[model samples]
Target chain A: MKEYQKSKINRIKRGQNRATYDVEKIDAILDAGFIGFVNYIFEGKPISIPMGYGRKGNKIYLHGSQANRMLTSLLKAKEISMTVMHLDGLVLARSGLHHSVNYRSATLFGTLKNLEDDLAKEEGLKCFMDHMMPGRWDGIRSMHQEELDRTLVAEMTIETASAKIRDVGVNDEPEDYNLDVWAGIVPLKQIAEYPVSDDQLKSGIKIPDHVMRYYEEYKY
Target chain B: MKEYQKSKINRIKRGQNRATYDVEKIDAILDAGFIGFVNYIFEGKPISIPMGYGRKGNKIYLHGSQANRMLTSLLKAKEISMTVMHLDGLVLARSGLHHSVNYRSATLFGTLKNLEDDLAKEEGLKCFMDHMMPGRWDGIRSMHQEELDRTLVAEMTIETASAKIRDVGVNDEPEDYNLDVWAGIVPLKQIAEYPVSDDQLKSGIKIPDHVMRYYEEYKY
Candidate 1:
């Protein structure tokens, strides 16, 4: 992990809205992410879209076609900001008015540029694969030069960033706490069920140990 | 589903872009969604935020603290445009260069109003809960009058709307497909895992059939 400098990070100092920072906690939350909800501007309006992504040393990589308006504009822009959020639970406060979401999110802003060469494109693809499945890239076929020519890979450094989180117990106003209202959190999580091997797998091919281990340990 | 006018929906159609859409499809996609990304000018630039939402017959319902800048300004404006999107799959084409995404999205234009009064507020709350969990309101306590007094609800009808979709396989330029590159769709889906019952539940409490049934029958 890179050391975060105060000047390099955006800080939210409001006590009532305190969930917007706490870097170590934020990094772990971001590392657990599978995708990001990318927000951008198009034709002078806002457009936000969910997209798959991977994080590297100090940058996040998201690749897709040049056809995407948001992606193309972002790649050619002066700066871009994107957020990755994990909605951990639904906070059902004692009072209806206080109900909110328990979530951990990280927002990063930086300039983005398309990955331009075969070697770099190949590395970016690995970052994408490893981000989605830690050990699957080496087991799959690698991309060739011509194959790299058609892909559009874009990378944005983690320049100005902030992590926000809210995980407190229900905060019912003092008077409402005695109203006999049900209050707590309804936690949500993501888990993979048993793996279904591909149809073309050889008969002798067994479910890999790591894959089986994930199913055994994670309840879905 | 309301019948959509083709011209209003296909305002930005790109013949070769499968992700570009016509009106009817946009309405269906929008109908399936319960939330939208609201982007409005804040301090001379756009600020996008994810908000809880609902849709009435022809209008969209969104509410928050009346103090929020985006909600207040948007409701008072002549028109505000918003976009909603769902990512379906990561299209990994034969070549990394052509990697794309299969998605369904919609953009709509409308004028909004801040809702008031007991009758409209109650109906709005019902729509919000139903949108969050289709059959959940009946399982929990209903909101009280005073609780409604502190909340805010707003509406925006669909004046002009459009929907776009991309649900195809790799569209590699012909030559790239035969270049020995791995290509196919990496499907993405949202699945509800087994529930983690509330810890404060009465001892020996059993999981309700409706909750269990929802998970069992859910395919994604």
Candidate 2:
């Protein structure tokens, strides 16, 4: 599908102009970020935990230690929601009431299930790593058996999702435009700095092309 | 109290060594970023929404349109949780299993209440704006009564919180250090670009000092 079916749970209420249910737009927002905040109810209180996720089609893969509290609680709930956001710029308006930020945010709702089989878990891990940094999985050494055994991998088959984007300049009141106020946007972006070598690296090992390429793509 | 009391709801189970319950440290983490993921329950499914917030002593302030769905739901629940995270770096390890990210993340649990009185609401709005840009609140045009009436301001008095910080280099297995692999950290940072003026601004208005100061402080 081209768009997610709007339901009571997945609809964006306020700022309807900024909302979109298109699957591709939502996927684009999701693909731009690796860390997402996953919500879980703990002792009747809803809490959010930031987790690294890999998206494949409508499926999001998350992995953690076998004994992770957040993961286990979410599994018991049978369903989950995750939100990823990228803050693009600060929209400074003439008046305090009009101040806003330009951002792209996507929230996903899905049914959750554990990927217990070894092959499924491996694929999930690959997706997770590749999502964070492309070409990373093959460049790094493969996971050891014990490492895979202790990790708890879970999949969320996205049932519905929505994305909201606000990318314009200052939106002030017509009357406020006459005032002598400095209003504009200060663009903000997450950038990568130079990589630092580990303290105990082997002497002859050079920074791989894949690593340099990833840095260049993210660098300012 | 200097540190939040440890309890089942606020404790960090997996990475206890990296967790801090200190009030000062947690506040520092919160002050670094204005955006937070606030959790709420929709159709019995816990979901998170990203919102801009302002933090004072032990209180977090959030404001939105009077009809905001997430804010209303949070007020109805009478409790709330928010998470703010800053991704510091990507830790590229020798093995895929050891790969991780360097971050400073804080999760807050609190009681929520509406700021009904104009003074209280104004204070909340000030906190919110000042948190975004230190000196922009006083510089901007003051809020009119109608604008304040249309806005809903809420304050959350933090009851408990936890912060986890991971800033070290790659932590690979002892034996994997002998392998000819490039392991290190690629530092990540959120930066500010030059301000883009609004299209409909008054002719003689120059970029204000406050905006330039903010850009300079955050610029690369």
Candidate 3:
């Protein structure tokens, strides 16, 4: 959530009856998950790829092989559009036609900037690691030069962004409302289970206290 | 799978050690989940959004409003690149630098054709419904003409596609193998809990026997 003008893309524009453009609401939805499908164009055609990304200081960062198509195209293209979304539940409507999903989605448009220097690259990697596990960065070995060179780190400025959401009861058309059809949201969620420790570790190396903290904090 | 020869795009190419080209293997990976981030571009800019999709024949189908950024941009562009991936586990190597995700992902390059007309839209909707719950199409009411006009149905043919997968032990450099770092895959999975029926269902209408079946038959 950077201090920038709110931007809304027409695609995520809510029609007459559905409109949601709240900033905190958008961040809350995004913080719930880690992976998003990123669609971009390389050489004038569209290429959508699945990627893991993290947000920090009004920017989103992604890393991949420099040889990869989507990343290569994006680098050359300089600009891109991305969406991060989560489907919370399946909305079962009384009228089959109204059946839809209860979801929260955020779409952003931005330019790609490569972090080529060593120090910046380290910070990018730190963001990546911390995103997955908040304080784990201090626990792991720092990225070495060669390993840093092998990865491509791209950052996108969060200039124009908006989040669209739909989370409510099923919208059963009047004619079908009392038809005895079962209707409601079948809540869906993404969760991390208990860690399965590495078998080769010394028998007594217990699960780190920090990792266990998430399990308790997260609602199953 | 379509009879058309499917070529693999080099941009989305998989590394020799990183590739899993088996069609069934790809299908299993795709079928294992329901939601993924979908990225695309509009006006030579990148836009990525997340959406739920289904696969049938040799193509992947996504349905949404005619105004979604990713969907609308994809519809107009016709040609698109898309990927659906799930990170199955974390592959930890003895060398921290070698750690990678044991995941299954598919990237496809193709054109998206909007499903026009009522009959085709109905069929597409059927494909979608059955994807989440088999036998649901027959159990639900058919879509009406107005409903068809309001929905956007599009499919991307799997022309040049490849599945990149990593599932087993860590790939550590020889010198680092004996460093005594604990290593293995931390398997991540989405487990399906017991189904909770809609409250409005008749008291005697217990979970349909068919709905009760998947819980016992599949892991997630």
Best candidate, lDDT = 2
Task: Give per-residue CA lDDT, model 1, range B1-220, as digits (tens).
Answer: 4544556323663434554444457657776655566766655434455666777666777877656656878877745677777666655544444555667777777778778877887777667766655555555556777667767778787777666678777666665534433445555444554545544543554555545555565433
- Candidate 1: which pairs clash? A19-A165, A150-B97, A150-B98, A151-B96, A151-B97, B9-B23, B26-B163
lDDT of 2 by residue, A100-181 (tens): 9999999888999999999999999999999999988988888889999999999999999898999998988989999988
Worst 10 residues of 2 chain A by lDDT: A69-78
**In candidate 1, what are the lDDT values of residues A133-170, reduced to their tens digit?**
56545544456655566567888787667776777767
DockQ ranking of the models: 2, 3, 1
True contacts kept of each: 0.13, 0.91, 0.31
TM values, all candidates: 0.75, 0.98, 0.83
lDDT tens digits, residues B28-125, model 2? 99999999999888777788889999999999999998889789888887889999999999999999888999999999998999999999999999
Q: Pick the candidate with the highest TM-score.
A: 2
Off by over 4 Å in 1: A1-18, A177-181, A196-219, B1-35, B41-47, B76-109, B134-150, B160-220
